[model samples]
Target chain A: MRLLSHNLLQCNVKNCKSNNFPLKIQVDKSNIINCEFRKEPLVKLIPKLDWNALAITVHNLAKNKEFPEKFSPALLDDQKFMQELHRILMETHIIEGALICEGCNKRYPIKNGIPNMILNDEEV
Target chain B: MATRPENICPPEIYYNQDEAVKYTNSTRIIEIQEQLTERCIELLNIPEGEDQLILDIGCGSGLSGAQLSEHNHHWVGIDISRDMLNVAVERESEGDLYEIDMGQGFNFRHGVFDSAISVSALQWLCVASKKSYNPVARLKKFFQSLYNSLRAGGKAVLQFYPDGAQQLEMITTAAMKCGFGGGVVVDYPNSAKAKKLYLVIQAGGDTREQNIV
Candidate 1:
C-alpha cells in the first residue's frame, strides 16, 4: 500500500480505541514507482496528512531522504519539499509487511502489496 | 447463471483464484464492467480533467479501478477476496489495494476520499452469509463507515443488484439512517437484463435534484 493510503488508515479491531491510528509498519519488502510529481494534490492533501506519522514512515522506510517531522503551510512553496512529499506519499509502496495495531497489537498482514484488513466475527 | 454468487457463497470463497482469473479474463465481463464504470463516473459528474482521490469498495481485480485510472483519478481499492487482489497485483494495478470486508466496516481517517464507488458489490452486505452475521447490523456498520470516509459534499455511486423492493428498501434505509442524502437511480428500468440500480449518495452536501431516475 502507498503511504498516502496508509496515512488514512486506522486500526479498527473491536473496542481497541486510543492510539489506533498510524498502524506501525513492519516492512519485509518495499518498492518505488516513478510517478510524475503533481504539486496541486500534494498541496491540497497537506492539511489531511498526519505529518508526524508520515515522517516516521519515511524515516523507517526511506532513510536517505530528509523529511520534516512537522508540517507547515510554507512547505508548499518549496518545490523540492513538495516533490519529496509526493515521492513518499504517492510513489513508495509497501510490498510485503504487517501493520501492527498499537492499541490491540493485532497484526494485519500485507501480501502482494495488498494489506489484509479483514477481521474475524469476534474482532468485529 | 440463475443463482447469484453472493447467495451461493461469501465473496472470499466465491472468488477463489480460478474464479477471479476467469472473471478478469472474460471479454464479456470486462466490457460490462467498463461500461458500468463509465456510467458511474458520468453520474459522479466531477469536473473535467480534475484529479481526485477515490475509494473503490469491493474493487475486484481492479476492473473498475482501471476506469478510475483512465479518468486520471487516484484510488484506494478494498476487496474481501485475496485471490481477486492477487490478480490485481499481477496486472500491476495503479491503485492501492487492500483486503477488507465491507460488512465489518473500514476506518479510514475521516474525510479522506473525494468520492467513492462500488460496482455490483453493496447487495452482498444484505446477505446473511454466516450464522454470526446479522444483515441489518452489518449494513448499518458499512454505511456508517462509508459516510465517515468521504469528504463533506463528497458523493458515492454504488451499483447493486437488489433481489426486490424489500432489499432495496433495506439498503436505502440503512444509508439514510447514516445521514446520507440522495436516492436510487435506476437505469434502463424497462429492460430487466440492462436494468442497473445505483445508490447515488451525497454526504453533507446540498441536495441536487438532477438525475433522479
Candidate 2:
C-alpha cells in the first residue's frame, strides 16, 4: 500500500475514533516507484493532513531520508520539500507489513501492495 | 439483467473465480457499469483544475476507478470481493484497491477524501449475508463513515440499483442521520430500462449551492 493511503488511514475500533492515528508501521519489504510529480495536489492536501503523523510515517517509510520534525507551511513552496512529499506520498510503498494503531492497538495487515483493513466483529 | 438469487451469499463468495472473470469479460455488464459510473461522476460536483482524492466504495474490477483515472484524479477503492479485485490487479489500474466490507465502519482518517462515488453497489447492503447483520444498522455504519471521511464541502454520489423505494428510503434516512444533505437525482426517469438512481449527498456544504452538472 502507498503511504499516501496509509497516511489517511486510522483504526476503526469504535471507541478509538477520537485519536487512532499515525498507525505504527512495521515493514518487511518496501518498494519505491517513479511517478510523475505534480505539486498542486500536495499543496491542496497539506491543510487536511495530520502533520505529526505524516512526519512520523515519512520517518519510518523513508528511513535514511530526512523529513522536517514538524510541518512548516513555507515548505509548500519549496521544490525539494514538495518532491520529498511526492516521493513518500505517491512513490514509497509497503508490500508486506502490519499497521498498528497507536491508539487502540488494532492491527491491519498489508499484502501484495494492498492493505487488508477488515476489522473483526469485536472491533466493529 | 436477470435477478440472481445468488445475492443470498456474501459478495466475496458470489463474485468468486468464474463469476469475477465473467463480469470482466461480459460486454453487457461492462457497458451498464460504465454508464452508471459516468452518471455518478457527473452528479459529483467537484470543481475542475485540481486533482481530488476520491473514495470508490465497492469498486469492482476497477471499472469505476478507470473513469476517475480518465479525469486525472487519484482514487482509492474498497471492495468486499477479492476475486473481483484480482481482475483489477491484472489490468494494472492506476489507483489503489483494498479488500474491505462497507457494512463495517471505515478505517480512514477524518475528512481525508475530497469526494466519493459508488456504482451499482450499496444495494447489496440491504440484504443480510449473515444472521448477525442488520440492514439498517449496516447502512448507518456505511453512511456515517462516509460522512466522516469526506471534506465538509465535498460530495459523495452513490449510484445504486436499489431493490425498491423502501431500500432507497432506508439508505437516505441513514445518510440524513449522519448530517448528509442533498437528494436523489434520477437519470432516464421515463425509461425503466435505462433508469438510474443517484443519491447526491453533500457533507456540510452550503444549502444555497444548487449547481447540478
Candidate 3:
C-alpha cells in the first residue's frame, strides 16, 4: 500500500489498544518504481497527511533527504513542492521489504510493490 | 423524516465517526457489540471466580460493560469522549465510569484488572493527521501498561479493524513482539468495506516468534 495509506491505517482488533496504528514499516527490501505525479492529488492530500510523520517517512525512504521544515500556504500552491510530494508519496514503492511496527514489532512485508500484511496462526 | 446522506453508510462503517456512532447506537450496533462481547467472553473462557475485576476500554454507552455487569462482575469503563461516556454511564448501574484517552493510556494502578476488553475502540488510535499523535507508539505504551496492569495470566480481549489482510498481519506481528500469545479472529460478517476482527492476547505469556524482522 502507499505510505499515504500506511500512515492512516490502524489496528482494529477489539481491544488491541496500544500503539496500534501506522504499524511500523520494516523495509527488509524495496523496489521504487516510477509512477506519474499528480499535483492535484498531492494538494488534496495535504489536509489528510501528518506532515511531520510523512516528512519523517519520506526522509527515511529517501535515505535522509530532508523535506521542507515547515508547511505553508505558499508551499501548498508551489508546483515544485507539489512535485516533490508527488514523487515521494506516489512514486516510491516497496519492491521488496517489510513495514514493522515499533509498538507491536509486527512486520508488514512489501512484495511485488504490494505490502503483504498477513498474520500467522500464533498472531491470529 | 430527513433523508440521510448517501455517503453516510459507505462500504466501511468505521471511517465516518458520525456514522459509526449512529450505527453503534442503533439496535444493530448494540446487537453486534453484544455478540462480539459474547464471543470475547467465550474466548476468555473466564473461569469461575467471585468479584473478578474487569476493565472495559471504549465502553461506548456501556453496552459491553452493561452486559458484563449483568454477570455480577466488577467493571470499570473508560472512554475519551465525555458524550460517549455519558451515554455509557446512563446505561450502566452507576459509579463505574471515567473519561480517558485510551491512546494516551488508562489511569489505573498496575496489576489492577483481572481481565480487559475493548470493543471497536482501537481504531480510534490513529490521528487523522500525523501532527495529531503517534497512535502506533501510543498503542504500544497502552499494551505495555496493560501487560503491567494485568495479574499474571490476565487476558485482554480486543476488537479492531485491519485495512486489509496486510494491516492484520502488521498488528499480529506487533502483538507478538509485545510478548502476547494469541491470534487474530477474522469474524466480520460483512466484507465490502473494512472488516472488523478480534485479537485475544494473554499478558506475561512466553514470547514465541520473531515475525516482524
Which regions in candidate 2 have their CA more than 4 angstroms from the true location?
B207-213
- DockQ for candidate 3: 0.01
The Cα local distance difference test for each model comes to 0.90, 0.83, 0.60
lDDT of 1 by residue, A77-120 (tens): 98888887888888888999899998989999998899999898
Worst 10 residues of 2 chain B by lDDT: B204-213
Which candidate's DockQ is highest? 1
lDDT (10s digit) by residue, model 1, range B1-213: 599888998889999999999999999999999998988898899977678889999899999999999888889999999999999989988899999999999999998888999998998898998888899999999999999999888899999999989999999999999999999999999998999999999998643333343
Cα miss at B73, model 2 (Å)? 1.2
Of candidates 3 and 1, the better by lDDT? 1
Displacement of the residue A78 alpha carbon in candidate 3, Å:
78
Which candidate number maximizes TM-score?
1
Docking class of 1: high
Specify the CAPRI tier of model 2: medium
Worst 10 residues of 3 chain B by lDDT: B4-13
Model 3 lDDT per residue over A1-124, tens place = 4565455444433345576654666665654446556465356556655566676676676665658756778887777777777766655544456666655666655543344433442343
Error of 3 at A46 (Å): 53
